[model samples]
Target: MTVRKATDVFSEWALRDRDEGMEEGHAKSVNDMLKMVIPKFTSPFSVIDVGCGNGWVCRYLESIENCYKAVGVDGSKEMILKAKIKGDGEFHLAQLPFWKPSIKFDLIHSMEFLYYLHDPFEMLKIFYEEWLKPGGILIAGIDHYSENTISLGWPKALNVNMSTFSENEWRKAMLDAGFIDVKIQRVGIKEGFVGTLAMLGQKLN
Candidate 1:
């Protein structure tokens, strides 16, 4: 599916179901992303959440002890509106693959968002160069990874364009995008769910 159509479908879903539209499995992935990074914030930090549905993650980050600022960017206007209504943070409506942040953040976090892009690697490069400050961390959680057999049919099942790759491929993409110390992890498994593949990398000076 083209970016336009995908955005429309997601926006419609958000308008209809609000936060509950996000699947429980995907919600766990977001929580895993948060748990993995929250302890890393030793000092006050700024964050930009990519594909931040309902801005719940941003709100959670803002509630952290050293979170100086939390901002959410999403392609769905209705999602942003819902976020603005109940979330405590700055929210912006912008397409993930084209969205650019004016201010670089200490951390760039994305959950279940990278695969929707036509070129996930290109998006990683953008986050590395344009959205993250030097030494900043970029963490992404993906449930539709290639290694997860249960999600192999996600593209056809969800009727969306998704790019699936091995965990190693994801780590390499981040490294190629100028991130150092790239790493990957599998987190939170339960019945009928394969869990989330989390990829992390940090911009180097």
Candidate 2:
């Protein structure tokens, strides 16, 4: 079976209002990632969520005490429309590795996203080199990795192309992007569900 591009699949999901379910379904794992990483943010921080779907993460980031700016970007127009409809944060349309924001952010976050890219490592490099300020943090989380046996079939089930990667491969990707002090761990596991693989890296200048 041929795999569809991720943006096409997700744009269809937005049209069918499946984006709402996405925010609900991934809330737990995304929240766990937020909790683990939020405390590290300094005051007056700015954030950008790549592949932010409906902008749920952007909304939440805006609510934090010291979060000054929160923005969400996705390749799908429908996904961006849904995020704008919610009216909490800035949302934009962009295809990754080919797009860069005019302003760099203090934190960059992505969930259920990186794996969809044909070249996630190159995207990570863009984040490090263009999208983040010195000392900025990049946290990427995904459920569809090699260890999550359940997610192994997602490519066919969802009909979208997904990169199959191991935990170590992901860690190496971050390190190779020139991010320092890289760390990788699993979060939000539940009975049969293996959990999301969360990775973090910082730009140390």
Candidate 3:
């Protein structure tokens, strides 16, 4: 789908309920997840948040003393606008496949956004080759694929699909993308319904 269509779909979802509390709740969840992943970095770092819906994650990173620079990129203009309104770092409205960073980051992050990509591995490779500095870290958090989630009520006609992978699968993919020391761990558990897995890896010199 085109970026405009994707932006419209996300904007519609964001505007629903018109509840500031919901947004705050989502931000809290994201922050909690990041806390688990960010400490793996040993020192001050430049970070990029891809598909940074509303930019909460980027803003949170900017608030940290060890974060050198925080940048956010999203396909949705409306989401980017919201991120800018939050006010801490730079927000770019650009679709994937056309995104080019002038500088490599010490950390690159994406949460719950990889499943939307048609070529996730290719994107990971690009991040490894072009966007990450030597010894940089890549963290991707995703919902695990299991029988319970396949049955969940999801829209069928949007021409969009989510592909979840097992922990080993993610580790292998990251390895193939030229990362080493790949580690995968589950972060949140929702009884028998859902869970999240965070896959982390480092670029080798």
Candidate 4:
């Protein structure tokens, strides 16, 4: 087994939800994400889920009436392999900010993953140009920076690196990347420790 960071270990635990009866936890989180994202989708549309750990969100979206195809992509090979076995949709393993897809999607989603990027804005711009169709929707779910409780002690203990931004900073970055109609809202609060921030935007014509 590879020496994995705490984040990677957590991601691996997500893959085991099917066996642990933790599907309910996954379902609840997906439901919250969908509730924040799905209103922007009007009709039958294709979706790409970036950093889709074990394809839980992809599978959840597939149950929706208007979601035609749900594709899952992840950087973790183990996660992708598990996703392929558990999900009906296609799963690919690729490093972020470098994936090239011939097909564009009506919606591109990233959850709990952007803060790990060294250059989130650069990646967002690439996603806008390469993955999203004109007038497409982008939904990103992040834990609020103001609420981040991972102190240095915690990071040392967990052996993971995390980066975060305030809601305004995220919105500005999206606008600078040429996204329009951007909106940010707090969707879920868990135990007063972690707060979910859902940012939705539309690609301009």
Q: lDDT of each structure? A: 0.83, 0.90, 0.73, 0.74
> Candidate 4, residue 54: CA error in Å?
0.5
lDDT of 4 by residue, 76-142 (tens): 7777777788766888888776677679999998777776666887878988888899998898876
RMSD of each: 1.9, 1.2, 3.1, 3.3
- The clash count of every prediction, one per candidate, is 0, 0, 0, 0
Ranking by TM-score: 2, 1, 3, 4
Q: Write the per-residue lDDT of candidate 2 for residues 87-169, one digit (tens) a residue.
A: 85789898886788999999999999998989998999999999999999998899999989989999888888889999999
Model 4's lDDT to the true fold?
0.74
lDDT of 4 at 85: 82
In Å, residue 143's CA in model 1 sits off its true spot by 0.5
The TM-score obtained by model 4 is 0.83
Candidate maximizing lDDT? 2
Residues 1-205, model 1: lDDT tens digits: 4434566767888878845657454677777777877787788999998888888788878888899999999988888888899866799999767668789999998888889888999999888888898889988988888779988887787688888899888888988999888878887777877778888888986
| Descending-lDDT candidate ranking | 2, 1, 4, 3
Segments in model 4 whose C-alpha atoms lie over 4 Å from true places: 1-29, 150-155
Give the 10-residue window scoring lowest on summed lDDT in candidate 4: 18-27
On the 0 to 100 scale, the lDDT of residue 55 in model 4 is 77
Any runs in candidate 3 off by more than 4 Å, and if so which? 1-5, 17-33, 144-159
lDDT of 2 at 110: 95
- Candidate 1 to truth, TM: 0.92
Candidate 1 lDDT trough over 10 residues, lowest sum: 1-10
lDDT of 2 at 13: 93
